[model samples]
Target: MKRLAALGWPALGVVTLVLLWVGAALYMGKPHVLPGPWAVAETMFSMRGPLVVAAAKSLSRVGVGWLAAAAVALPAGWAMGAVPALDRELRALLSLLRPIPPFVWLPLLLLWVGIGEPSSWMVCFVAALFPILAHARQGVAETPVALAAAAENLGATGLHLWARVRVPAALPLTFTGLKAGWSLAWMSVVAAELVGADGGLGQLILDSRNLARPDLAMSGMAVLGAVAAVTGGLLGWAERRVAE
Candidate 1:
């Protein structure tokens, strides 16, 4: 019953939203401006093949870019957090870079990579990298010094200390960062695709707009939102497991 209620509320919320949307569309009486839910659903089914391919392409870019960012961020963040001297040296530089929106890099990337897959991947990487790095650093920095000393007294040192003590302690915040980074990566991929891609959900939306099909455009957006929600739910589940 508890589980059912938990699911029930979200389902109810979705139904409410759909009803509101349908009402608004009917009130406006402008299908081009705001497609009804039924129209969007029809568009989704009709464009399933293209939508699937576009989603796949976007997901591939997100996966590769996020992984690359994580690979660099984990160790780099750990080192910076574990070493005050290093942190001090890099903090100013990071502060400068972190505030810059990931899309701002798109133009430079387009020039360098020529509006290709690499540019898209780079944009996603940039979007994801900072949050992951910042969270990782914070996690390591917040590790209790007393715990580290205790581990040391028990003959734990260096890698052993890090693996057994620091890493475990930092797991929660690190996962938080990872989840945030993934969301940013997903958004960045869509933006990148919109700006310069041959095929992607973002491009599909643009194509629909060019062809004056608001229903298809709305359908593409709905699909993107659905995919992101599912992925985010999985990540949240994993985070809960780790916390447990």
Candidate 2:
């Protein structure tokens, strides 16, 4: 009951949004220009097959890229935090690279590798990498000095100490980075797909515009929004579990 009550405000907001949308769509009476919610819903249902396939492809790309980023970032970030010399060495380089958008690499990557999964994966990897890496380093570096001293006094050493003390202490911030990376991965995948994807939600939206089907484009947007909602819910649940 409390959970349902907690969700009530958000549900009301959605309802309000839909109501306003219906009103605007009705007043405009231009289905081709700005489709009503029902029209987009109909398009979503009618184009379910293609939508599913596109969503799946994009999701797979995100999964691969995010996982790859986590694999590299977790270890590298830990090392940077563990070793002051390493952090000093990489800090300047990281600052230089982080500001360059993932899409900047797309053209060069496309020219080199051709448009496909490789390009998409690379874009997603680049997008997801920085935050996870930065946050992980911060998390470990910020672990209490007293905690480390205590652990040392208890005869904890090396990787075992890291595993028991630093990892747990770092998890909250690390998870924050993971969630941020995951979100960025989705955004990057869409951008990557818009240019080179044979099939993806981004391509679907682009095609809808070219075909003059606003409803279809809106349907694609709705699907992406649904994905965001689902991702947020799952990430939130996982965060709570770790916190517990």
Candidate 3:
């Protein structure tokens, strides 16, 4: 019953949104400018094949970038968090970089890596890196000193102390960072693809615009939103399990 209520609320919200969208489209009386929900849905179904291929490509880029970011950021963040000296040295640099949007790197990446898969992956990596790194540092910094002392007294030192005491304590916050990083990575990959790409949902949207097909463009956006929502829901469920 509780689960039904949880699902019902969001379903209601989506229905309400669709109605509003349809109404707005009717008021405009121009399908080209703002296609109604039905038109978008039709376009989505019609382009399923191309959409699937594009979505797969985008997901692949996100997956590769996210994993790479996790590998580099987690260790670097842990090291910085564990050592005050290292944290102090890097804090200012990180602060400067954090505010810069991932999309801003597009032109530079294009220049450096050329207009290809590598550039897209690089942008996604940058997007995912900061949040993960920040959270990891915070998680480690917030670990109880008493816990570390206890482990040390028990002959836990160096890597063993970090592995058994620090990391376990910080897992929850680390997971939070991972979730945030993934969201950023997803967004970044889409933007990267939109700007310059041979294939992906973003590229599909761009192509739709060029072809004067607003319905198709909206369909691509809907697909992107749906995919992000599903992935986020799964991540949230996993996060809850980890917390429990």
Candidate 4:
């Protein structure tokens, strides 16, 4: 009974949204521009295989790029946080690069890496790196001085101090960065896929537009939204587990 009660509002909200969507579609009277839910559902069902394949490809690219971003960000952030001189030295360069939008690098990357997986990954890497580094730097910088002093007194030095004291202290903020980086990476991958890829959710949307299929385009958009939502939720759950 309690479980059913807990589920009720969400179910009700879903139904309400469906009704509202149907009402708008019917009232709008332009199937070509704004297909009804049923039309979109049909598009989704009929093209499930292609959608799944495209989603998988996009997810793979995003995963690799995101991991690479974390690899670079964590170590660099740790170094910058632990050493004030290094942080100051990198500050000017970071400032210049950070303000430059991720997409702005696309042209340069396209020229260097060409239109391929490398270029796509580069876009994702750039998009994911800054947030993680920013959050990580903040996390490490905010570690309590007293805690560090205690660790030093206890004979923790050099790498041990960073490993035991800094990393753990920074975990929460670092987690925040990871979550943000994941989202940014996902969006960046889709954008990159759309711009030049042969196949992906982005490419599917591009194809739909080329074929004048608004229903298909909308379906792709919906799938992208769903993927991002699920991924974000899973990451948040993992963060909570880590925190505990």
The residue pairs in collision within model 4 are none
Candidate 1 — number of clashing residue pairs?
0
Q: List the residue pairs that clash in candidate 3.
A: none
Residue-by-residue lDDT tens digits, candidate 3, 1-244: 9999999999999999998998999999999999899998888898999998988899899989999999999999988999999999999999999999999999999999999899999998999999999999999999999999999999999889988999988888899999999999999888899887789998998898899999989888888888888888888899888667
lDDT of 3 at 48: 93
Per-residue lDDT of model 1, residues 1-244, tens digit only? 9999999999999999999998999999999889899999998998899989988998889999999999999889988999999999999999999999998999999999988799999998999899999999999999999999999999999899999999988888898888899999999888899997779889998899899999988888998998999898999999898778
Q: lDDT of all predictions, in order shown?
A: 0.92, 0.91, 0.91, 0.89
lDDT of 4 by residue, 135-232 (tens): 89889988999999999999999989988899999999998999899898888887788775668898999999999999999888888988998989
Error of 4 at 199 (Å): 0.6
Candidates 1 and 3 compared: the better one by TM-score is 1
Better of 2 and 4 by lDDT: 2
Q: What value does the lDDT take at residue 54 in candidate 3?
A: 89
Give TM per candidate: 0.96, 0.96, 0.94, 0.92
In candidate 2, position 204 carries an lDDT of 89
For candidate 1, give the lDDT: 0.92
RMSD of each: 1.3, 1.3, 1.5, 2.3
User: Which one wins by TM-score: 3 or 4?
Assistant: 3
